[model samples]
Each structure stands twice: as structure tokens, then as C-alpha cells.
Target: MEHSSVHHPEMPHIPSTLTLASRTPTVGSARKSETRHILVIYVGGTLGMKPNSENSLAPVAGYLTTEMRRMRELNPPSDDFAQQGSSSSSNSFSSAALSNEMRVPTFDVIEYAQLLDSSDMDQQDWLVIARDIERYYYLYDGFLIAHGTDTMHYTATALSFLLHNLAKPVILTGAMVPLMEPYNDARRNLVVGMMFAASTEICEVCIFCNDVLLRGNRSVKVRHTLSAFSSPNYPALSVMEAQPFRPRRHLLARPPTGPLAIHSDMSGRVMTVLCHPDFDAESVKTMIQGTSKEAESRLDCVVLELMGVGNTTSTMARTLQSVVNTASRVGCLVAITTQDLYGSLTAASVSRLKKSCPDAIFVGDMTTEAAAVKAMYLFGKKLTAAEVKEWMPRNIRGEVTTVASRL
Candidate 1:
């Protein structure tokens, strides 16, 4: 695999034989002397896109890494200054001065052969990424993935499950505007992502976009703004700021006890259904029934993105209940999530629907993307329908908020 590193004349010379080490320091000790090595997988996104002949932004091969190399932020400082960088004070360096210093981080970029518009990403693409991380898990301190904004949350949620017991940061970030654009958010997003990846403070999959470090599964895309993503149900793990970089230690995932395990088995058999005012029962029934016996046999789970707080109109309610009941009878998992970005599918919130579809799994406050990816992960494990139902509500990979049931 070919990779590139940015070099500068003013920066201290990096040794060819220099070893990469984790930024994690021993407890009760000062920072580690070695520089952290981060692997940035540029999988094609707005961050690396340029205008096509049609004037629409599109992924260009090798554009992202080239653009990143042109920026001063991606490169590290000279080896001499980096080796001298043991400061007792975290606030000693000004953000402006730090930007030009050699203390930032050292990283390599692996651009994908085929750049994908995030909308084009699917299970196969996710599998490829998961396998690559697993293949190189031991070689790097942390990893950053540059992906398209359209489906970044889905990819992040998939990776959160795929990379089990993650002990290093796997940050997914992209820009709302193309990197080549005169006014774009790409540079800042990429810089912050690199800094976070090189740190030992976070050890789970996350999305850092528009300065917010959000839990991967908790994030949702906000299409209309420069801050393209937000974590509505949870507090940000950290905020990317200028000058002093202080991560919120309390919000980070607990340290993992075992070596990282990768679970690449994802079943595309899971389906997601949206319940709107115009939803029809027969259409849903057909989806549940499948076109034929063979297809129905392969179906394992369904994620229902229901109306606010898991409610539906009386007509829609009956349709959902009937379909859910049929799905239950067929030993297929049925999970419920609310469309409301800020609320959850608590017992009180879905009381009406629960009365008729008692067996449905309630995924409170999990984003639709998380619900879909989690369902796919669970189904891929070939767990029984009962096990899927039980695990769906559990806080696996921090996908959902567990609350005490009022019932």
C-alpha cells in the first residue's frame, strides 16, 4: 500500500528509522517520548472532491491527500523540537504557535483506489474498511477515515460495531464543502480529526465534524449548515478549539481490557422502514412477507423509524401492529426507533404501540443509522430472534441510552 507524508523545510528532519508509538502514557507518569503514528484512510468524500464538468462536487482520485499535503496543518514539526517536547503544563503552548510547531502529530495517508460519493457506500464498502483496519490494527496508534458526508453516520455506526472493543480512536470526518472550494470547512475538520486520532484520550469510534467530537452512533447529519453533523441525544465527548486542546476525559469510553477484535460479518438482510402519515399496511406486509420464500428466509430483522415517540395514526398503528406481529410470529426481530432526534422510545412514549406490538424491541434515542447498522451486526452474528430482541435495547457500543423503565 502506497502512502504519503508531508515534509517541510523549516520542520525538524524526521528520522527514517523512527518508530511509531501510542500517545498513551503510563499512569502517574509524564507523556511518552515517542511520536504517535496515525493512519488516515482517505475513502473519498467531500473533503477530497472537486467540481466535475457538470459543476457538481465529485470525488477525484488522489485529490484529498494532495490537498492535505499542501496544507501546513497535516505535517509534523522537526524531530529535534518534537523530542524536546516534555511539558508539565498542558496549557504552555499557544494554539497559534502550536499550529507551526513540530509537536502536532505524524501521520500517513492511504487513499482509496475508487473514491465513493458517500451516498454510494454500502455493506461491501464497509466490509472493505473493517478488514483494512483489522489488517493494520497493530501497526498504528490510531486511525482516521475521510468519508463523504451523506452517509458518514451509517459508516461510523457500522464501524463502531465491526471494530469490537476498540482501544484506539477511529474517527470519521468529512466536510460539507469541497476541500478545493475557496471557502470550505475541510481543513479545520481534518486537522482536528488528526489531533484526536493521535491522542490516547478517546478509544471508540467517533465523528469529529465542525469542531464537535461526537460518539459515532449518536451523530446525525444536519444538511443545511457548515456544522453538518450533531449529536442530539448525547453531550459531545470534546470540542475542537484553537490553541489549547483539552478533551473531556469523563465522556470518553472506558479502557478496553482485551485486544481489539474485528467482527466483519454483517448481514445485509436487515431492512429499515419509515412510518409516515401516508404509510400503507399492504406495502409493509409485502416487505415483511418478501417476494418469495427464499427471500423471506434470508430476512432477519427490521428497524422501524416511527413517528414522534414511536406513535402512529390509528390506521397506521393497526398496520404496524399487524406487520410487527407477523414478523414476530416468523421469528424475525422487530426494532422500533423514533424519528424525533432528541427523544427516545421509552415505555411511556410508545405505550399505545406497545399494547399491540408488545414483542417489538425499543431502541430509545438511537439514531436511525445506528439502529439499522446494529440490527445488521446482530443479525450477521446469526443470533436467534429472542437474542436479537434482548440485545437491541442493550447499550452495546454505546448506541442507545439505557433508562430505568417507568413501567
Candidate 2:
């Protein structure tokens, strides 16, 4: 991946309303916040990508505004769309051009001056989104993130852990295909996501795409289809057809009582190791306990992606015990998660894993993505090793399901 400074020099670290409502495709001002008002943070993604002079598709800053104006569903104007340089900012982006069933919201769109592919995103990039939401927490009733699909689930999971005490909607969305194409789900998904923000009380981080609403931490990128994401170990929060979302209220996350806060501190030292038939104990040892040159080898945490029910080779397990023991002595957490999509670690699995590696934290049913971010979030909070272990398996952000509930 290219360096972030080379790509994102123009995107504001502290978000400012850059696209003017009067001369741009936006509908409202950042300074004004009211009930039913939505804020769209257009973090560069394929939805806004356009053919560069080289004919290769690339994210072009402010291009989404152009396409949105052309779509009568968002601008609702019959005029020459390209000539709408000074269109009214009081306009609404709604389902009118498509349908009248979904709620129409007055919204403001903010774009990064320099667009970067989400594949290059890191903890710092995730921090930017979290901080922006924190600054504008009280301004809008809900939030929408127009992001790239490559890492959309990762961002959703990171945000779920980074933003604490969330009491309003924070929906992440992106298009499988670009809006510049003759036909795509770009406009459709955006309309539906905005409608959810305007009409629902889903008071936590969520991902909405291809008519599927999923808990952010519970979501996974399943395939290249229109619905590229799924909550493999969990249930869909909502599934909308011709009508608006009839969310399973019981599945929705309840809002916390305290005011919203962002956790800015995070340790990127965590690593993910996958267990396989050829999983070498030497490589695992080298990973968990760094070389002699780098003495402090126990990273902040290590996510062990094991086979079904958190099983591993008897030989590898015995070999890993020594390294895990070393990492455990120095405050490094070892979280165990299953490689199977629907797999949940059982008590027997935990018991067996404990015998092999005494310092393992059983992370039942939480997707590998969730486990990784949860580790960084917990470590970022400066939590002690014991506290991190205590919280790893507990359902903090609806990421993990109860074994009893599954039964």
C-alpha cells in the first residue's frame, strides 16, 4: 500500500464542511443540526470513483456530489444536472426519484480533500472517522459513512469498539459498483441507509448494504455480490424489501445512558495468526516472541484464528503453550476464535484449549475481525491484562452471542 501522507494530504484531520450547500451537491450546513437531520461523511470509496485520464477507475474527490445531482432521486430537479452548480442547499436527497415510501432526510455531505482507497486504511484512518463523529455527536440525529467495501466491515467493527456510549445511529455503507456506471446499487443503498438514519432508533454502529442491516461488530464481508456483507454468527438486524426496514427490535442494540465518547488511543501492535495443517511452531514462536534483537516480543495482543471449535494440532498446541506462556507473562493477550463462519467455541473446546495453552481467552462466535479490533480497543483503553481477558469473551458491543441463546 502507498503511504497515507502521499494519498491523504488534502483530507482534513479535523473534519470541516467542505462542500458548500449552495454550489455543491449537499443539502444542509454542518453548523445546523436538528431532529431527522443526517450527516454523510463521504470517506472515499468505489461509489465515488470515476475514470481518470488513464481510464482506470479511481476515487475522485467531489464526484459523488456530481452523480447525486444527476440522480433525480437525490436532487429532484429536471434541469441540466451539470449546470446545477448553484442549486438550492435546502433540497432533500430522498427516494422520490425511485420511490415515495422511504423517509426523506435533509443532509450535509463532507468529503476528504484527498481520497484514499480503504484498503490502505489503518488505525489512524479509523480514528479520523471516530473523531469526526465525536465532534458532531450532538449536531445530527444520526450518521452515515459512505466508505469502500474492501475494508468496510473492518471499519464498522473498529468504530463499534472505538466509539463508546453510542446512543444514535452510525451506519456505514458503500457500493459494490460505482455510481458512474449506467446501472448500480450506489444510489439505492445510499437512499436506504439515509432512510434508516432518519426513521430508526438503532442506537449503535451498523452496516447497511443491499437491503441488509447488520450490527457493525457482527458483520463480515461474505462475497462480491450486491450484498457483500453478512452477520455470519449473528442474525440480520433488518431486511428491507419494497418497504422501509422493519428491524427486529430485539436484535437492535440499546443505546447507553451516558453521553457519547470516542476512544482515541489504540495500539496497532496486535497481530492475527491463522492455524493450518502446515502451521509451523517455529513461525508461531517467532511471531509471538520476537527475535533476540527485538527483546520485547510479546505484542499488545495476538488473535489466534483456530479451526472449528478452536481446535489445533496436538503437536502445534503443545509447542505454542511455551510461547503463549512467555507472552502471557508480559501482559500479551492470546484470544482464541474459530475459523468457521458459524462456529462458536464451546465449553469443552475452551477446556481443551486451556490445557494446551494456559493463557488463552476464548472468544466465542465473535468474527475474527471483531476479535482483532476489540483487542486494540481494549489495549487502547490502558486496561490491565486481567481486565482485557475478562472482557474478551463478554458481549460488550453485541459482537458475541450467548451460547444459551444459540441452544
Candidate 3:
């Protein structure tokens, strides 16, 4: 994908009227500054979109940053605004309140040259974002990814695996409505994302939208409501409350001990097959059984979105087992996750299916998105079949609620 870098010179400056918390004395009576810098990576999404020639909301290059500059919430604190206070006698109080507002961090936006609708995103797009984060990992205190809502969960899950041993906050957010609209969620999402990124509390890749901060790998876009995403199995890490700009913290991932490591070489040879009432065994066989020897060699894994609690019709069960057997015989890993969004793949639930397919690896309560991306990540590392099987069941990045079981 083509891309360009444009620097925004006007950094947000704190107002002089606001009294900051006393800083620790530094060398020779100087005080350490509290300001934080964040790198905002603007990968094309609905948040930055504007009306195109046909008047449909579409991503417009350079438009997002321009609009960001106009928002007073994002802009630097201005003394001029403090001077021209509110009309009532409470002007001083209002000015004082404004002065005491949450300190917005200075950030730079790197817009992709060819903005993409989330639907257009693929493994290569995931690679591009991963590479960008790896390249600028150390330069900024934290990172914010503005992505399209359609595939944001997938990208978030991919990034969680790609940016291994991540030590800083990498918050992903996007808007259902464009930022240019009068009433939109973009501003709040971006603002909350910025606040979280600047803090030292969260160190994992997370998605912040509709007031909830969730683990990137665990979150899924649930509906078309303003609260577009939710972590079905996992609890949210934090909640954004605007009254005093306080974000209530919940469970958080431990900080990494080693330096950040990025794994960009993702193998896209993994296939996800969904089980249904009208499932076709021949098609499943065709997918797992590659047409050519070369194609078969390239195929590494299959993530089957099995029926509730990892079950299927008795007729389809035998066929599915045979397909899994075939896939395993040819060095491809077969991992099974449930189609239901909220249940674990318990041994009791899948006992019948397990009897037919003892080799199938059951991923317990792991989101299909995480299962797919984790398979790709493991395959990209060129792990042996045994190693892949061994690691798939383990909670590498908190993807699975319970240890995966292999019958």
C-alpha cells in the first residue's frame, strides 16, 4: 500500500492559568515535564471519512487531521479562550474548570496514502500496520490506531500477536459516524484513546470504543449501536467517564519485561470454515485437500467454527473427522472453536464429536478472530505440527479463556 508522512507542527500546549501538580525537582532546580507524546496512525476508517463526489461517506486523505485540528478538545489549551470567558458571572469558575480539564497529549498523525475501507483490509494490510508500529515503537510514549469498524477486531487481534511482548499501550479506535458530522462518536473515541495511550497503566493492545476499553484480542464488533464493540468472554479493562475525565480501571495485563518484539511474517494460508446445517463435506474436503502439491504444502492450518459446544450432525461428524484426519496427515493443523460467542468448548459438550475426531484441537472459549490470527502467527514461525498443536492450546496472549484440549 502507498503511504505518505506529513508532520503536524502545532502540538497541544497546556494553558498557563492551569496549575499543574508539583513536579519532582530535577537536576539544578529544573522540573521534569509531564507531557506525553503519542503517535496516531490513521489507517483509513469511517472516523476520518467525508462525503465524496457521489455524496457517500468515504475516506478522504488529509481530511482527518485537518478536522482534528479544529476540535477544541484536541487542540492546545489557549489563553485567548481563557480571556474570553463565559457570559455569566460564573465565567471565572468555568475558566477554572476548563483549566483543570484533562491534559491532552501531543500527537502526530500518519495517514495512509490510499485510505481503505475496513472491508478491503487483509493480511497484507495487517502487516503494514504491524510494520509501522514496529518501526516507530520506541519514538513515542504510546500509539493509537484509527481503523475502520468493520474489521477492527480482526486487525486488533492480529496486532496483539504481531506486536509480541508489547510494553506500551496500543489503543485501537474508530467511529461508526464520520468525525465531520455534527453528532458523532469519533471525537469521544479519539479523545478517550489519546488519554489512555498517555497513561502508564495499560500496556497491552486494546480497543477503546463506546466508553469501554477492551482487550484487543477479546473484543468483537457486536452491533450497529454507538457502542459497537464488546468483549464477550473477557471483562473490559477500563471505562471512560467524561464528567471528570476519569477512566475506571479493571483487569490489566502485566507489563513486559523484555524489549518489544514484532512478528510481521504472517502466513495467510490458514482457512476458516463455518459449520452449518447445510454444510457440504465435499467442499470441506476440497478446501483442506489442496488441488496441487505446492498448494497443499502452503496450507498450514484450518480454524473450524464448529456448531454450539463444538458439535455437528452425526452424518457431518464422520465427514468432518475424515477431513481433519486428512488435514493432519498432510501437516496442517486443525483447531476447533465454537460458533457461539459466549460458551466454552467443554469435553462433555463435544464428547460425541471427539469420539469421531480425537485429533481435533478444541480451543476453549477463544474468539474465532483470535483463533484464526493465532494460527497464522504460529504457522508464520514455521513451527512443527507437534509444536503448533502444543502451542495452540496454550494461552499465549490471553486469547483463550481455558487451556485448549485435544481429544
**Each model's C-alpha lDDT?**
0.73, 0.73, 0.74
RMSD to truth, every model: 6.8, 6.2, 7.1
Off by over 4 Å in 2: 1-17, 20-35, 76-101, 292-298, 309-313, 403-407
Of candidate 2, the 10-residue stretch with the lowest lDDT total is 1-10
- Output the better candidate (2/3) by lDDT: 3
Best by TM-score: 3
The window of 10 residues in a row where model 1 has the poorest summed lDDT is: 14-23
The TM-scores of all predictions, comma-separated, are 0.84, 0.84, 0.84
The C-alpha local distance difference test score for the whole of candidate 1 amounts to 0.73
How well is each residue in 1-407 modelled by candidate 2, as lDDT tens digits? 12122112323344333542322223333322322567787888888898899998899877886665555555544343332233443335423233222544656677777677889898878888888788767756788899999899999999988888888889999998888888988888887788777645688889999988899999889899897998887789889866444667888887686878875476646889887856775776666676544535458788878774335566657656765786776667788888888867677877878777767888888999899998888878877778778888888888897532100
Off by over 4 Å in 1: 1-32, 76-103, 295-298, 308-313, 403-407
In Å, residue 288's CA in model 3 sits off its true spot by 1.0
Per-residue accuracy of model 3 over 339-405 as CA lDDT, tens digit each: 7888676667678667778788887788888988888888777676788788887887777776422
For lDDT, candidate 1 versus 3, the one ahead is 3
